[model samples]
Target: MKKKIKLTVWMITISLLIAAVLFVLQQHSFSMTEQKIEIDTPQGQLTGTLVLPESYSGTVGLVVFVHGDGPVNDTYDDGYKPLWEKLASAGYASLSLNKPGIGGSSGNWLEQSMEDRAQETIYAINWAKALPMIDAQAIGLWGASQAGWVIPKIVKKVPDLAFSILVSPAIQWISQGQYNTRQEMILEGFSEKEIKKREDYNAQILLLLKEQASYESYLRIAQSDDLISKEKWGFFSKNYQSDASEDLKNFTTPVHLVLGGQDINVDVEETERIYREKIPKNLLSVFYLPDADHSMLSKKNASSPLRTYLTAVFFPRHIVVEQYLDDLVHFVSQF
Candidate 1:
């Protein structure tokens, strides 16, 4: 009788453990399918991935994802992969491509202009439209960081884009440069006077960028010994503009703007001002998450040990990833 009781207890424990494991697996389980294809761009053949949701019905909406300033990959290290998975789980097909020279794609990304990049995006859209299971009419562009600048240019060219979603986009690279300069000074314990001088220089740089000044002009103004590197300035000037306000005003597609209030890279307040004042209210969706730093992670109290540690590691205090996705899901669903 004693032996039988012990055996029964062992069986029950094993069964409970198995049940718990299964439950955990179920929570994390999501169906996803991926394929690689070569897309024809004006520059050359671009390699990219087409990810489809599990149990997808025929002709679902497609999301063409454009990465920030990084080499695109088949997986999430590109930063947009997690969101792509979320979109897939929500029953949307997603496509992410390698920028011109990276991955399996061909051509040089460094030499491409904004117009060149926008044309590449249109090529991807055309590819998505050719997929039998994709709803070409419902296709949309989801751009983050630098890709924000790319989206408007693409939409203006394509004119048939269903909607666009921008995350932490640099609408005014000049303002963003100044904001970043100030943040760096504050972090380094610079005096107010020194910081103000830096601010003044940044403002000048911003003006030059806004006017679409030649890269040589930007380089000359940014030549001070105390200023940021010429390479950084050249890259920014080449990739972004200081006066995108006019271009934004011409946009007619539905736009969703998600910004972290505590973001140090961009002037969130100035950005908000432009959106609210310049942009038509009917076409915009804006969400400002407070106490959230650039990456959108929530910050603890200023005095907290965790806050200090995170600050040391330069982690953003904003709840960017999750909050942005939630807002994105809500906004896209409306379409």
Candidate 2:
């Protein structure tokens, strides 16, 4: 009877611990107090916010958030607030910028190359390093998606970079777009034959870029009824030849790469394969969450493209799962 009672007590204790963990996860999301900050860059005056955590003391490390595609606002006003808050509550400072031509910042993000973005971000890194409240030695970066290309460029040249947190980043711009096209078609329930037709056309574009072929070559790939508009061709022309494989090889900083196994926008398997092939596993901590989609939310309910495009104007509709949130916190805490 004594042994039976002891087992019951242990089980109760375990249940209580699980409940406490769940409670902390649920309550972790909170609003943060941030300072309006801006910096002058050669391209324009870059504007952003340096969000601070409450009830913290001592010089804290700062996380500079590098946004993915499109014009990202200073706060990532759409979806990133919760992440900033969680990081802040865990004793790290966060900063996010208004991309060029967005908010008070000038210049065009679309017009800038990976090189231009890296230079601008390097400027921000220097600015953060010099700040008195920031732990200059612990300045790091957090980026995702298109930033997969941009962050590698930054790390390749800047050896002093402290660390990095990457989520659902792409490997090659060209292949990534192909993956998006194919997977989007699959999600829309297209036939395997239709998928191959699209993928084959994209492959031709890769060959054209490699052969330094003319505009006519790419034009041939654009079908008359295709959803891709002619106006967007400029984007393909500028970035189709770019890849981050070399940049990944040069990365010396400790990196934590997170992926959504169910991500429809990117080829997660290829991404993991390349990272392991290019960098030593010792410098990396990789996570593949099967149930999470590209947004690190549920695959069953991913955010709409329209909603993502309007992030500068409103709040994010989706919240990252507790599992992802926990993994991020644990990774950042290591540094």
Candidate 3:
């Protein structure tokens, strides 16, 4: 009897290990498979990867990813795989393009304005529509951060965009930057005087930006602060002027706006306020993750802004919250 009981325990343990390995292998297979493609925009050609869901057939919906600020490459700074894989499991095809100067794409990304970026995205959408495997009428845009400025412009131009998913979108470009700065300062425990200095600094910098101040003039303003590098100044000058108030109100596209309550970047509260005011009830849907950060990762101490930032940057930041994926799946399926 004792020998029989020991054999049973061994068999159960072996079965559990085999099951775990098989599950991991299945997940690997479900991740999006890459295909090379190129799109011609007004500026130049964008070389990108069209990722199709494994086992997907019979014309799946397409999701085109736009990047946030900076030189975000085709993989969205190497943080898009999990999200894209989740979408793939839900039977969606997705594309992520290398910015003009990043991978095999053409043109200089830093020189492009919001209008230029929007045009690039439109080109990508058209390219996706032409693919034999994609449902053209069901194409949608998915992006976060600076994409908030780009996506609305896209829906405005196309007017027939199938759906959209915005994660931690900013209401407006300049205001969002200010909001980010303030939030960071508060988290770093800046004093009232220090915060006031930043506010004053933001006012002046924005004024110069609005006036289309020369790079040299911006340099003069930056001499007082070392935080603004030459690279950063160039990025701001090129992509800084955008107001989404009109676009937000006018976009009739089905929008699933996701906000992270623990996000330490943009003022999620302010963005939500604008959404409530401008977005029509029928047009807008939402998913709020109270303990998730801007990247939809679980946070240990969301209430403490400092801990939130550190966790997002250094440790355990790559774990995607399950609810974020579920929210996206529900949004995509409904539309």
Candidate 4:
């Protein structure tokens, strides 16, 4: 009788634990209503998601997300939902579109220039503004990484934007690339001599890009295993000159800049300095997260593959710095 009672208690405990896990997963969607949205642009049809507050009666303010880099899909494989949920809770709507050739969207992402990206975002903004459920005057942008090059251009064109949020944005393309390479090398324990050699190679590649050299020209000089594809080369040739300093000066809306101190991909200090020099103090707000990485993920989680996987699977919302999400909501709430 004692053995049977112990077995029953163990079974009950396991059952309750499973039930709690399921409940957490079910509630992960939070209080947001997400819908499949499609936008037609000159480039092609864009597949996207429009997330809105579940219980709001009036039109909500909208935030259109611009991807940093890569062929990212809407929601960034659900990585953006935490942010979406935060926005929803604050009575705001968020829109995110998959890059061209991704998630059934038409055209090719690598074929687009920075200007093309800005124009595509403008198209999304205009489409959202026409919806009766979104307040046109309350529309803004949230972008990161390569988006630093894109968002400022959007701000330049859309002078009346409600606000702009930039995360780990770099000021110049060439310098940012160099910084990333150096930091990554240092982290990997590369010697000074080896680092200098790689930088010299990068300089050569930059010169080729500046000269508009063809793929064949690059092939002749590139190492056998280091050759970039023609498409990637074309992308580099088109955007290697990207510098946001001039475009940032055109900002006419409130801007919130988030920088992660432990970020290796960008020189956050340089980004902050340039932003301060270019944007008026009254229009810019800065948030610095000392323990975060380029993606605003905590250094502890970002550095451990096992921890990253475990956290992403069990606590996806906490994959990034919780404070980063809170700051995003706080900044947008003011508007």
> Could you say which candidate leads in lDDT?
4
Predicted candidate 2 versus true structure: per-residue lDDT over 94-114, tens digit per residue = 888889888888887777777
Each prediction's Cα RMSD?
A: 7.1, 10.4, 6.1, 2.4
**Which scores better on TM-score, 3 or 4?**
4
Please rank every candidate by lDDT, starting with the best. Answer: 4, 3, 2, 1
CA deviation > 4 Å runs, candidate 2 = 1-29, 200-221, 224-231, 303-318
State TM-scores per candidate: 0.74, 0.81, 0.83, 0.94
Q: Which lDDT value does model 2 have at 255?
A: 88
Best by TM-score: 4
Candidate 1: the clashing residue pairs are: 292-318, 293-317, 293-318, 296-318, 296-319, 296-320, 297-317, 297-318, 297-319
**Local distance difference test, each candidate:** 0.71, 0.79, 0.80, 0.92
Candidate 3 ranges beyond 4 A from true positions: 1-30, 224-231, 301-318
List, residue by residue over 107-173, the lDDT tens digit for candidate 3: 8787777778888999998888888999988889998878888888888888888988889888777
On a 0 to 100 scale, what is the lDDT of residue 43 in model 2? 72
Q: What is the lDDT of candidate 4?
A: 0.92
Worst 10 residues of 3 by lDDT: 310-319
**Tens digit per residue, CA lDDT, model 4, 1-335:** 99999999999999999997896787465678999999987777999999999898878999999999898999898889989999998889999999998998888899999999999999999999999999999999999999999998988888889999999999999999999999999999999999999999999999999888899999988998888989899888989999998999989889999999899999999999999999999999999999999999999998998998777767888999999999999999998
* Quality of model 3 by C-alpha lDDT: 0.80
Please, what are the lDDT tens digits per residue for candidate 1 over residues 69-176? 655564434345456667876778888888877787887666566667778888889878988999878888887766766787787777777888777777665557
